[model samples]
Target: MPGLQTQSIHAGRSIDPSTGAVVPPLHTSTTFERDPDGEFSRRYAYIRAATPNRDSLEACITALEGGDETISFGSGMAASFGVFQALAPKDHVLLHRDVYYGVRELMEGFFAKWGLNHTLVDMRDIDEVRRASRPETKLFWVETPTNPLIEVVDIRAVAEAARAACALLVCENTFATPVLQRPFELGADIVVHSLTKYLGGHSDAMGGSVTLKNKPELVAQIRDFQHTGGAILSPFDCWLILRGVETLVPRVRLHCENARLIAEFLSTHKGVSKVRYPGLVNDPGHAVAKTQMKDFGGMLSFEIRGGRAEAFAFTAALKTIARATSLGGTHSLIEHRASIEGKTTRAPESLLRLSVGLEDANDLIHDLDQALGSII
Candidate 1:
């Protein structure tokens, strides 16, 4: 129970009440009975409001993160949008420049004019982050070992930045998971996750969850927003995610090992111009990564020797590894980063991202070796 492996085994799950099943059953009921006085909103009154299945999933996440409250959403973007909506109109936010493409696009495009001002800065530079601060800034969104690039920004350092600016720091712990890194202890006010990826671990479910640090009112507001605004995950998806949680700890450990090996291999490969992973000793953020993260996680990116053509060739040459995006799944995945982000400058061309799954290390090495050999 002390370690992640043990915690994952028993956290946020149980047998059916009606039947003695070990795994929690999917409660598809839209409403639950209440007193006739209308004194209660009733359990599972509305699909959008709340459900036993959703609460069970939230409780598990809450225990795992040591957060007071957690909210589940239909998608990662919906959870993120809810976070923004909870903030004030005059709030200016400082965020990492290399965040997820969808969030970056949303912040720059729609939310910018929606009275929520944002400043995207290279978070590694403490001075730059300090300089970009605005008095009205309220949220500091960050992602370490960021999507595709694997840039490791110092959470504690940025947390200091947020504290000085009077902004609440929120870290996207999807890649590392609570198993690898606890943002709450690192001075983050909130933590976000795309359960569709690592939390689900199979990429079978699309869901998101957010955890608040000791903020009951904030938790209540997000819960209200989830209930009223209606982005709650389906009972089935929540149940699937609940299942994924049972193996998260063990899966993440293996993912980290596989990723580290691949990063080292890619670093020495002549076909790769650059490999971005905090686990590498030569990486600029390696020290900070070691300090903050329990492991460097399963995601790493390498720039192909040539531009888009070489990257495409290399990806197309993969055999066992799937040529696709999304991280922390059981099957290894390779993504041509530029293709998904369109015009966003966050993801670079010639860079290929890898999500090291539960596959054997040697097989993955062979796959990469063959792909690189064929790229020329």
Candidate 2:
């Protein structure tokens, strides 16, 4: 097999047969012509069902994740919705207590209304996972190095529980992209990603994917949902994500490097009450993360000394790192996750989530030092 870097550049890419272009041509046509015998010989009937660009993007993700098949969607939430839609009404899903706020909204706000059931549990506790299982449980949704809190879950342990319950295990790999962690290798049945993050690397595109590990029946079901539901990723966005995949390896390496330095810096600061990063030897998730992940990943969060007011002040004082919502881009971003998550937020009132970017490590530390100084 080709190395990750090599695969990133060459996988799903080919020279244009007719134009002789080195890069794959972006196919924008919504509909394809049929054969004279009323056959769609080219195999693509319409954009929603399939498209050249989307197929190429899906191929790249499938290869990178080492999955049997991958299904692309317009956004991360759409991909998640596709998975839930695959389950029958009244089926139960076990969600990480600190999973992305949007996912909670999807289950509690929308899916609940449709008779779908869900329960939130601390995935770090294998016993908690086993205790939460019900006869109707159909899925176990996990997010390692969880959103905002940066809490890591042991995938292998959780997969065991899922197996005993006869439930499908779905791992959200958005934070720890394929570069740092391979969930399928760790026993995940399905892997999902928000291409809007690390895979896009540049934040210019919005997309998501669900990759199945040898589950042919599930693949067909989700593919049918993707086609009939019409929430497929756009061709242009697919091309953009493919372009990002070419440099994912190097970009993620730098993200990990810079994040480690920043986490260490924050740990010793008096104004920071806690630093949540698996790279830290003292972190609660350190041992488990080190066993499963190649590196600790780029996202981290810390609690300010005071309350929400202090957290807001610190972020406002930063000159270089922007106060932003999303992560995995060229620019570093910081957000008070509590405020963003609203009333039901589990994030500490003093917590700030930082999305380390491809920037000078010293400069980022200095920027943080000055901001903490201002707040202190």
Give me the overall lDDT of model 1: 0.87
Write candidate 2's Cα lDDT for 1-376 as tens digits. Answer: 9988888888778888899898988899999999999999879988889998898899889889999899999999999998998998899999999999999999999999989999999999999999999999999999988998899999999999999999999999999999889999999999999999999989799999999997999998999989998989889999999999999999999999999999999999999999999999999999999998999999999999999999989998999999998999989999999888999899989999999999899999999999999988
Candidate 1, residue 370: how far the Cα is off, in Å: 0.8
- lDDT string, candidate 1, 1-376, tens digits: 4566656656666666678888777889886676688655545566677787898888888788878889999988888887888887778888889898888887878787888898889999999999999888888999887886788889999999899988899999888899889999899989999899888889899899999977787888888889888888999999888888889988998999999899999899999999989899999879999999988899888899989988888888899999877777899999887888887656668988899989999999999999999976
After superposition, candidate 1 runs with Cα above 4 Å error: 39-42
Error of 1 at 223 (Å): 1.5
lDDT of 1 at 106: 78
- Clashing pairs for predicted structure model 2, backbone only: none
